[model samples]
Target: MKFSTNELLPLVSRLDQLLRTAEIGDYPGAFNGLQIENQGVVSRIVAAVDACEAVILQAAREPGTLLLVHHGLFWSGAQPIKGILYRKLKAALDGDLALYSSHLPLDLHPSLGNNVLLAKSLGLTGLKPSLELKGQSVGVMGKIKPMKREKFEALLCKSVGGRVHLAPGGPETIASVLVVTGGAGGEVARAADLKVDAFVTGEGPHWSFTAAEELGLNLFYGGHYATEVFGVKALARWLSEGTGLPWSFLDHPSGL
Candidate 1:
């Protein structure tokens, strides 16, 4: 089954409003809405974290496929569209693959966002928006039944499906957590200021470790890629259910 871009506009528009794609501020490169257009129609949807060459080629394999991503192309800003960039664009144009990206918007989405999903995966309650970035709350803070630090770390490791680096700076028992998926480790000071028992985020700089220790905040680094897969997957599933258009997630992990 195929759907025209016009038919999909309402759904996409609804998402833009729900996610505040236009109102919310994002990095200039985020270019949050539809980035690439196809030949006016779509047959299947492919969701992935980054719009890298491999993922673009994969989506291109299926003509009229809309590639949904968190980090879209053009991160490097205005440069000659040659080499890898040229190849990616060529593949999409040749194969009729459309592309759409949502960065901060997807991260802060109330239900189908990375931060909220990650918090939910760890069974956190009393979830509330936190961590302002460009006047938008891009992180979530929530309460967890107080548990031993080790037990909480174990649960976090399980949630992200990989190794977790823990800075055991907080109390032996953890009762609350702040989640900001993807490279928010630099926000250790901000999380500490929030006074949450712990802070969960993707990779951070080396100093963040000592800072967490100094600030007495439990910090968990759960790999940027691993923690961010939630938004795209959830968005894809929601779209499929709402529009009856089949979709698939392209697993391309960047072990950071």
Candidate 2:
């Protein structure tokens, strides 16, 4: 089914509504909206985790690809279209693609959102909003019945469809795990302060591993794109259900 840009805007607006209801993001990342317009009409939709240079190149292949992403372009200062930046811009413009992005807005959605999905996958119960970030509660921190760290990592791997990179710390049996999807490893210090049994997120810097060891906290690195793919896929399913739009998820993997 084809939808004009105007027709699809409502469907897209519903997506934003769901995200607003779901997200728990703080103010660190900004400008989570339609970053670019390529075509007046949108026929095929592509949902991915990031709007990076490589993903941009991939989207360029489809003429008028309406790329929906968890991470939007131009989050930082605007730079001149030169070098790699030039390539990314040129590809999107040349493809006549429109880019729509939702960051923290996508993470905390109740149903069909990253945090909720992840939490449910791990059998987390009584999940409710706990922490706030960037004037918005973008992350979900809740209680879960104690489980083994290995079992928790296995669930993460199965849910995200990736190999688990686990830095096992603390006890074999964990009572509560703190989960922040999509590169929230930098929050390790905060998780440590909370003294959770295990902390799970996507990607980690050099220091995070050390800190996890020092603090005796279990750490799971489940690839950034892999972990975040849940939200967009859920959003796409939601759009399909709500608007009857034939949406497709562009299964792109970033082995980061």
Candidate 1 structure quality by residue, lDDT tens digits, 20-70 = 888888876557888888876767878999999989998999887878899
Candidate 1 TM-score, true structure as reference: 0.95
- Maximum-lDDT candidate: 1
Least accurate stretch of 10 residues (summed lDDT) in model 1? 1-10
**Per-model TM against the reference:** 0.95, 0.85
Segments in model 1 whose C-alpha atoms lie over 4 Å from true places: 1-11
Q: Which stretches of candidate 2 lie over 4 Å from their true place?
A: 1-8, 21-29
Model 1 residue 205 CA deviation (Å) reads 0.9
Q: Report lDDT (CA) for all predictions.
A: 0.88, 0.74
